[model samples]
Target: MSETVTLPRPDDWHLHLRDGAMLTAVAPESARHFGRAIIMPNLVPPVVTGADAAAYRDRIMAALPAGSRFTPLMTLYLTEETDPADVVAAHESGLVTAVKLYPAGATTNSASGVRDFTRVHGVLEAMAEAGVPLCVHGEVTDPEIDIFDREAVFIERVLDPIRHATPGLRVVMEHITTQDGVAYVREGGPDIAGTITAHHLVINRNHLLVGGIRPHYYCLPVAKREAHRLALRAAATGDCDRFFLGTDSAPHPDGAKESACGCAGCFTAPNALSIVAQVFEQEGALDRLEAFVSRNGPAFYGLPVNEDTLTLARQDAPVAYPDRIDAGGEDVTVFDPGFPLHWQVT
Candidate 1:
């Protein structure tokens, strides 16, 4: 017989609540499903300082619709010039939970990403001392390696070394997309943890190529083969304490997606939790869902688990995706948009 489980409310360890009108439009979807979220700092200009993080958090808070009890856990975007003192200041002010490291040119709005690992060693060392986490978009931005293999390469070439260099520093490999990434994070000891996105567990590379180029299926550290997807499901649902949920649910307007050069991201926030629940059920690990979504993230981040409670029932539901936000004429499609979701959040 299956057991019914009720657990502490979950937090999105990684999320992209873009600023401005998009922030107003998309913040509610995430807030409705999560008690708190670690908001991504990769905006157009990026949130590189503590003040920027605090201001962005206020914007996210304002965007949240009425009656929504969502807390935005902001992060600072790390750059080569990022002062180590700022890392300590941000943590001390309680404005940011972690410092996001996007290797230069790795993803959207990542132009200001750290140029070299050594450049930010000071910041990393400071985070180690402060007990703060360093959230990484773990993909090497080298031209030689095939796009699909960047995450795997980064694990061996960059992340491993960084881990060795900073012994006690806590690191979260955000939106892990490959089996190699999964294994590296799992075996790399307790100081290293990973955040798994909802889409990677449910969709594979074929989904993007099938039936023409599905732009909505596009995202950084792009989806991998079905075998990798299966591996991810196993790792996330498995007893590994290193894996947790981070729905890099980015919203791009339909226009940006339909252009000659399309942006890469999936607006999974609208249906993120349901997708995870469905994947867990399919993997025969539904009983472990609570830990993956709730306990593990906070435990890894050294934060108190929320007191709120949320329920996911095995029921059919539909999720809708708007072509664009009401405030702007932006154009892009969200992942799993307008689909019949198999799980419902209550």
Candidate 2:
């Protein structure tokens, strides 16, 4: 016998749909399941302006599969020189949904990220007034700080200060990977929310470092201790409206991932739903999966819940998933949860 659970078609609050060939290859994978996704703007040059967002949106739309209803919610990449007026105008005109803050050198293609947060104060203040949400990478790039401690240190130094300076700023702490991050968002008031990745819910530092280096499991705000992983799992499945799904499904060329200095991301878009279903079911919270994946994100972003639904069936046999996606001349590996997944998004 097979058990099934149906959910409102989910939206990925954080996603990276690279560009050109890569975009063409990966866009359909997400479109096949998700109704909408907050498209990342950290392109090589980055999507930093209204005109840039509009143009990028066109590219993304063209890349999507024919007749696909997947909507790409475009965002602007915040730099020290970002114009508050431009950000507000794009949001007002509906060309952009939010603005992303990547600390310089924090992650892939983030060299243009803010080095001095103060340089973007005006932009942040304007976003606060205009009701545009700020999606932050949430890790500092200080060389002295241990990689494992960056998220916690960032909370104490960068994020909290900015949030306090601009009181009404709606912020989404993207890809939060620490118990500290969990605590901050849980205690941080209504205006602040946190996004949990499908990979983070399943992997910890051990998953990344235990036997040997696992490049595919690496992501920015890298996975933390087992205790932190458990904290994230609880926050995701528990009764918290401020926490929701953000897979951060970044794709990298197979060579780029397996190189001497590999890229930091897990190409999880292909099997995100299956991985999340198993996690929620294990947590004994199947009733709440819809809220975490579908309802909460919309509630925080001021968007309506997706009207369509997708059903996941729990079958006797483990579902077989594709190992890699062919993109241009290279391959992008899909994330492996390191376990058998029985739920299939049918």
State the lDDT of candidate 1 residue by residue for 82-190, as single tens digits: 9889879889888779999999999999999988789889889889999889999999999999998999999889888998899899899999988898888888888
| Candidate number achieving the greatest lDDT relative to the actual structure | 2
* Candidate 2 per-residue lDDT over residues 205-265, each given as its tens digit: 9999989999999889788999999999999999989999999999999999998999999
Highest TM-score against the true fold, candidate: 2
Q: Cα lDDT of model 2 overall?
A: 0.94
lDDT for every model? 0.85, 0.94
Backbone clash numbers for all candidates listed: 5, 0
Model 1 accuracy (lDDT, Cα): 0.85
lDDT of 2 at 334: 95
TM-score of 2: 0.99
